[model samples]
Target chain A: MKLKGYRRPDGRIGIRNHVLVLPCSLCASETARFTASLVDGAVYIPNQGGCAMVKKDLEITLEVLSGLAANPNVYGTVIIGNNCEGVQASLLAEKIREKTNKPLETVVIREAGGTIKAVELASRYAAQMSREAGMLEKEAFDISELILGTECGGSDPTSGLAANPVLGKVSDKLVELGATVILSETSELVGTEEVLAPRCKDEATKEKLLRIIRENEAHFERAGESLRFGNPSPGNKEGGLTTLEEKSLGCIHKAGESTIMDVYGYGEMIHSKGLVVMDTPGQDIASIAAMVAGGAQLVIFTTGRGTPTGNGIVPVIKITGNAETAQLMADNIDFDASSAITEGRDMEELAEGLFELAVQTVNGQKTKAESLGFNDMSLARECNFC
Target chain B: MYGCVKLHEKDTVATAILPITSGEEVHYRFGGQELTVKACTDVPVYHKLALVDLKKGDVVTKYGQKIGYALQDIPKGAHVHTHNLYSTMPKEASTQEE
Candidate 1:
């Protein structure tokens, strides 16, 4: 199917054209936010770390920041930084340049003489980028150019029975049309790893899936705990889930029945087509952030209870199967799959409707979360900072 | 109308599509036969209900996967929840029963 999108200079297609005002360190976040607020179509990401991060944490932060700048949705970036921070504005700008030939400008608070001067300089750059971005006309792109991310949060029985199965159907249709699907949340996959691993395209891929699951289990074991302690969270139990295994079974339904293609680490760019897995924690914001950083232009989130999480650049389409939650949280939810349970809506028909809505979203429809300005973001931390 | 959704043919438990009260006759299709079970206790919406008689220590299956174990002998129509079923895995001390 053909859909309208913005074609990036790097040959990638994006559903949204946004000028980003990015902070390179925590010290520059306020300046970045002020700069973005001044521009008509600019979005800013708050940097929560960068001053004293250890080697691994610093590397991950740099990758996530650069990835955000290079994401196809971003038309251009104005990076703001404190001159003496661990991550320099110039270095971050260079990293983004290495990935894409898009427009990039930098402002250092120290070099610009203070936060006021930095915001002023950065806002001017952001405004110019926003104007330039606004000038680009939308072009038609094939479905193959799209990378779709799947996630489930605030789950209940309906999640597995209705919402997730509906998502699975949509996921299958997208993969059949040659789009890439990213299934994440390694912690949620603990008990179902054996069931999912065999679906990998090759032995190596299968082994990688198994290894990640084992490592996740070991991570908890090392701390004298079990994954079950947190897998079926308090909300999950209240929603009627009992164990990690049961939750995993329900969670895996979001991937549909597609063959697993490749496995990637958190925030790693995905280049393969078909269904791939990203090793991410079960925390909703961090998991979605990794997928967005990995180049997913759109995300389909299934929630039995409901969530209002949305990414700054990529649009999050929230789907819920709980009939009551859908009606009660009408302002937060995007699609209601409750008909499958209450009104006996066919799974395939519900999936087709969802697919159509996704196309419409890609063609410029605003999701409920986007309209509400729910720009939630979080970077995955591997360990404590030094 | 109140109903229950059985996700898979192999599942021994079904989820309530709506709140079911004690003595309400809930009908479901099982193994190509239409069957009815009277709710022995109130089953809130989204909670589980036993589809068959379950003895203590019996594994309860939903979504065709193990969800928990029956903590007491449960009749076919009994409500299945923390009161009658508990997680087989070690529980987190932080998650006290609500």
Candidate 2:
């Protein structure tokens, strides 16, 4: 399948033409927000992790910022930052430029004389970038050029039977088409790691996969806690799930039956093109943020509990396996795979329908989240390190 | 009536649908074999229920994932929650239960 996409100068594909106003540090987030607000076509991601975070946290921030800037959805970017923050604005702009030679600019608050000056300079750059972005035309791109990020939230029984499996079908089809599919949320992969590890393409990859899972487990041990007890949230309980292991089992279905080609940390760039697993928390916003940071142009989020979260640089396609949820939260959910469970619809048919919708979205059709202007995003920060 | 959610093919436990009362009979299925479980406690909804006898430290599965291990021996039909069930490996405190 082919859809119209913006071809970046760096040989990447973008489905959205956005002028991004990125904050280099947490301190500059508000200023970037105001600057983005000044332009009709600009978007900004807000978070509190760019400063005072430890090296790993800062590294993740830098990667997420760079990835967002490199994301195809962004046509041009104007990075705004405080001069003395941990991840410098100039450094971020350099990294972004390294990935994509698209139009780029930077403004430091101290150098610009403060928030007002920074906003003025950023708005000027953003407006100019927006105009240039508007002049570019969309061209036909093969489905193989797409990287699909699969996620789920507010899950219930039908998620595994309906939305997740259908997504898995789509994942299989996409991989067959030579596209990339990212199945994220390592915490959700607990009970099923043994099954998932064997599906890796090779022993080394499988070993690496197991190692990461064990590392996550060990990390939890150090904290004197466990991922299981914290899982199957209140919503999951109400939806009839009883344990974390149960949630993990159902969550693994989102990856389909394909072999995991590689695993990546949160906000890391995805180098391999086939199915990959990104270690991320299960929170909708944080998980989606990491996926976007990892360079997903589009995300397919399955929600049984239903949420209205979207990303600044990527379009989040919301699907649900619950028919009642589709009805109760019709405005938030885009595709209704609940038919797979409620109406006994075949997974193949539902998968095809979802695939078509994904193609349409790639071709510039707005998702419900996008249409609602829901640009909810946040960086996952562990703690401050001196 | 607590519904059992199977975690994996090899798992011997299914997650609880709701808090199960001690000695209440609940019907569940596994590997195409249906069985009746007598709840052993007010098993919180979204916890676990032993489909078979579990030894101390036996890994507990739900959604076919190792959510935790039994802190002590758990009998068939026993309720698994914060008390009897612990994470397979200690890790981060639970963050998704919100």
Candidate 3:
């Protein structure tokens, strides 16, 4: 299907055209927000990890910041930071520049003597970029130019039976079209990594798949928690999932039967084609944010209970299989797959309907969450021990 | 089914498994027993159901494994939730008795 999408110089497709003001570190977050507020068309995300993070976490943070700048929806970026931080604004800006030569600017709060000076300087850059971003007209892009990110939140039994299976169908269809599909949330795939490995097209890919999952699980073990038992949060328990294994079984279904292409580290750019996995935390907001940071233009989210999560630059399509939830939270749910289970509706049909809706969303249809301004994206940072 | 909550054969309790309304009817087979329930109360999406009678401190199994224990005697078909049940597992256990 052909839909109007923004074509980035880096060959990425974007559903929205936005100018982003990014904070380099937590210390400069307020300044970035203030800068964005001064501009009518600019958006900024305030985060806690700009400095003091370990090497791996810092690299991930830098990658996320730079990838957001390279995101097709972002017309330009004005990176704001403290000069003393581990990741300097200039370095991050340079990295982003390497990815996309889009309008780039940077400001240092410490060098400018305070938040006020930094805000004034950053706002001037953001406003100019926003005006430039407004000048681009929408152009048609094919489905092959899209990268679909799949995720689920507020899972229940209907998750595996309906919502997730529907997503699996959608994922497989998208892969058949030669489009990229990202399936992350490694914690959610705990017991099912073995199931995922055989689907890899190569032995190397299979090893990477297992390695990615093991690394994430080991990280949790170091914290004295089994990711398997730790997830299915209190809310998930209240919603009926008993063990991590059961949850994993339901969660992995979202990937469908696509061959695994490659595995990416958190916040790392995915240049490979077809279905890939990212080593990501199971936290919905964090995982989705990481996918966006890695350059996913649109996100397809499935939920059994319901969630109001979204992204600033990318549009998130919210879907649910709980008929009552679809009715109760009509204002939140976008597509209804509950009928697949209750009415014995075909999953393929529901998936086709969802795919159509997702294409519509890419063509500028507002999702329930996006309409509600639920742009809750968070950068993932590996915890540190003091 | 969307809201057809079921318990494994070895489980002592079942869950709504999916979101259900106050008057919704859900059918499932558990412990070789085919049962149907008309929800008496508006149950939140994933709340548990008492599969069989259980006295205080009886193990509560879900997905065929122990998730927790009944803190008080829970009658058949009673809603099992945080108020009446607590995880007896090593991690995430509740200390207070109901």
Q: All candidates' TM-scores?
A: 0.85, 0.79, 0.78
Model 3 has an lDDT value of 0.76
Ranking by TM-score: 1, 2, 3
Q: Count the clashes in each prediction.
A: 0, 24, 2
Query: What's chain A's TM-score in each predicted model?
Result: 0.95, 0.94, 0.93
> Which model is ahead, 1 or 3, in terms of lDDT?
1
Ranking by DockQ: 1, 2, 3
Task: Note the DockQ of each predicted structure.
Answer: 0.29, 0.16, 0.10
What stretches of model 3 exceed 4 Å from their correct place? A228-246, A384-386, B1-98
DockQ of candidate 3 compared with the true complex:
0.10
Model 3 superposed RMSD (Cα): 7.8
lDDT string for model 1 (A1-386, tens) is 89999999899999999999999888988888899889998999977887788877777888788888888999999999989898888889888887888999999998999999888899999999988998999999999989999999998777987899889889999999999999999887876764687789999999999898888877767767677556667677677666565677788878777899999988887899999999888888888888988889999999988988898999999999889999999999999998877755666778888999999999999999889877787887766210
Error of 3 at A371 (Å): 1.9
Q: Give per-residue lDDT, candidate 1, residue A18.
A: 94
- Order of models, best lDDT first: 1, 2, 3
Best model number under DockQ: 1
TM-score result, candidate 2: 0.79
Write candidate 3's Cα lDDT for A36-67 as tens digits: 88898788887778798789777888888898
Q: What is the lDDT of residue A203 in candidate 3?
A: 92
